[model samples]
Target chain A: MIPAAFEYTRARSLADALKAAGTRGTKVIAGGQSLVPLLRFRLAQPSVVVDIGHLPQLQGIKRAKQGTVIGAATTYRDLLDSKLLHNTHPIIAETTAGIGDRQVRNRGTIGGGLAHADPASDMPAVVLALDAVLTLQSRRGKRSVPARKFFKGPFATAMKKDELLTEILLPFLPQGAGTAYESFEQAASGYALVGVAAVVAVSGGAVTHAAVGITGLADTPFFAASAAKLIGRTPNKEILRAAAAAAVEGVSANEDIHASAEYRLHLARVAVRKALTTAAGRAG
Target chain B: MTQTITLNVNGQALKAQAEPRTLLVHMLRDELNLTGTQVGCDTSQCGACTVLLDGRAVKSCSVLAVQAEGHKITTIEGLARDGTLHPVQQAFWEKHGLQCGFCTPGFVMTTVELLRDNPDPTEDEIRHALEGNVCRCTGYQNIVAAVRSAASALRGSRRPGAAVSGG
Candidate 1:
């Protein structure tokens, strides 16, 4: 199916991209893998397409004093090859690998996936668990939104239409921190039916702190706060299982042709338990 | 307005004027008229449209034609050298890897990427790497065997233009 005819503007820089996006009926598209499909399905019909493919300002993976800052337009393939990010946050690496086939990975951008605000996306939950910050820019100004606040609902984000998600600020993982991502991938679309990102900090062989980020099982990517509070105190199997159950206490997962809401909830519980176990084991 | 994008396909630089949203599969099939790159699934699920973009295999359908501009792309047609079959092709032929020949291009492109990533992949590694590239015929047993054979043949032969990699 052909995408509806629209004016195309290629942005060479982030500022230009946001400026173009400020125009009426314009949409910013990077790594068209996700947005193009929506266009083909008539789910999104923007009058003008702002291409960030040429945006030099929105590219690269670098180890910085703050953390590993990832340009929103960087492709998944680049993320997979990022040595710094691999050493720092393997959860991002692990979660990105679960996304679709090689073609999808080669073309899909992590920033696009998050900004698209797909509740089923694996990155948002993991990024939230990592405490990654998103930089959003518009003609008005720039603001940094913590991952928790960035995602508002399923297929919904707090991003203004004219704003550009230019960078992802992933803090350097501290030593003794263990992170793991577990997901039950939906076969057809290759998104998570439910994804859990667990970050556990261990002190002297005991649980010091834990951040439980659950995605694809709720309207928004969120910290399983109730579950985290309980699971953070102890890392035993019984507690882990109970925390997994609590993570889904009120989660209303999105249901489609692939799986039912009940099935997704079950997977979310299983995934959380598995993720927590992996995280605890890997904790330094 | 259309943009002029350059692509190196089968060792020829083909410049095509295309819409910003044009899929890479269209430039190859319509402009270059090199129909080897098949568009099996436009949504990036089916690997039928896989091609090498800057030495990496990617779904041509999922990317805009403009995205590939100024990059080296290798289509399935460029697999052979001096009119001889590439090792993977030879292995597939010897091992009877094709049933309908629809998914062969994707498999070939994936194998190219696999060998580039891991030259000596274990059978299980081969299985994991090729799992994304599906085959309807032979139940993939013969295809797996073909890849195994191709990996061995290409490893020792340091042919001028050939590189050993993938499952």
Candidate 2:
């Protein structure tokens, strides 16, 4: 499974990486979990591969003004080991733990995953629900993209080929908020057949903030606007069920050998219901 | 184009020339002549190419040889010392953990990490830890038993006055 021959640049710094990335036909390689597979399969034949996995600037989880700033290159294993992430956004850790397996987690990066924008990947829905912001860097300049606007389609993103995703900014959840991610995974690949992330903030026994993100049910992971229906309403079983149903309303499920479109929608509804219930229970 | 990359394998600093596209598994088996690591599923789904990268288990097939430049890589061949099988290897041998023996290296390497992180793991924990490695034989029962045996043996050796068995 050798990849096609390509020039490799081991970038020593952020500037070096950005410079290399700006070159035509250059592909950034971080962690190389997803990109390596694509390279091996000949699905992507970049003339140059810029290795940025070891760049010191693109590492670590830090406390920020609004919430937490997680380096895009931070691995899932590192995320699991972070007490700050566990305390501030436990759902990130919880969802990451279920991605692929131990070996994959050791090498997969959040930035790589988000930039790859695999519709079946778990983190897109998570960041969407968390309302995370992504910082993109390039030789030209820097810009920020909210997670909601990041995914354009399967294996596509708002990022330009010359830009690199540097940091993911997870905004602090509202005071009374709790977040949870739920998924029905394909048995073999562990990719989500249907995944949902819910952030519920309850205030005075009423739902104040409700955001739902869904994946594996369409061409791209999306913020389910129908979740707004729960706003200002008491989050009882009936209300939660209705909101879950509405979350998948108008969504066109993707069909494949793994599941039929109808079945995928069914799983999406079930997952939404479970995620919302669990998140509401954990809400302060 | 080939690049010379130096890697620390089994406490030895070795150098090999490989293309940027060369996978670490190929470099280990072909260039270094360490064939213990198998490539069951080249797509990284199967852990047949599992190896320790700086004391953590990672699928070598998924890692580029160039990416392993500064990391310490420990393969199944590195487990034994002076012809004596490592405890985890010995446990698998004694417990008949392997039937076909094709997936042994990966399972053994993965267990090396599992036991290192957790000296005493429940059956479910062992099963979950080795989820990446797949064994077609023994129904995973003997494999689980082998990990349990190795864990206890390693724990016992750590106690005071216990015979210091080589890792």
DockQ per candidate, 2 decimals: 0.51, 0.84
Stretches > 4 Å off in candidate 2: B161-167
Write one digit per residue (lDDT tens) for candidate 2, span A1-284: 78999988799889999998788888989988899999999898999999999888899999999999999899998999899999999999889988889888988898889988999999999999999999999989999999999999999999987899999999999998988999999998899999999999999999999999998899899999889789899889989999888999888889999999999999998999999999999997
lDDT of 1 by residue, A1-284 (tens): 76676767677766778788788888888888788778766678888887896576888998888899999889898898989889988887888877766667777888898888888788888988888889998989999999878888878898887788889999877668899999887766667778899988777766776778888887788877765575336687987788788877887786777778888888988998898888988986
- The positional error of residue A282 in candidate 1, measured at the CA in angstroms, is 1.1
Candidate topping lDDT: 2
lDDT of 2 at B147: 97
Please report, as a residue range, the 10-residue window in candidate 1 chain B with the lowest summed lDDT.
B158-167
Clashing pairs in 1: B114-B165, B114-B166, B115-B165, B115-B166, B116-B165
lDDT of candidate 1 vs native?
0.81
Clashing pairs for model 2 are none
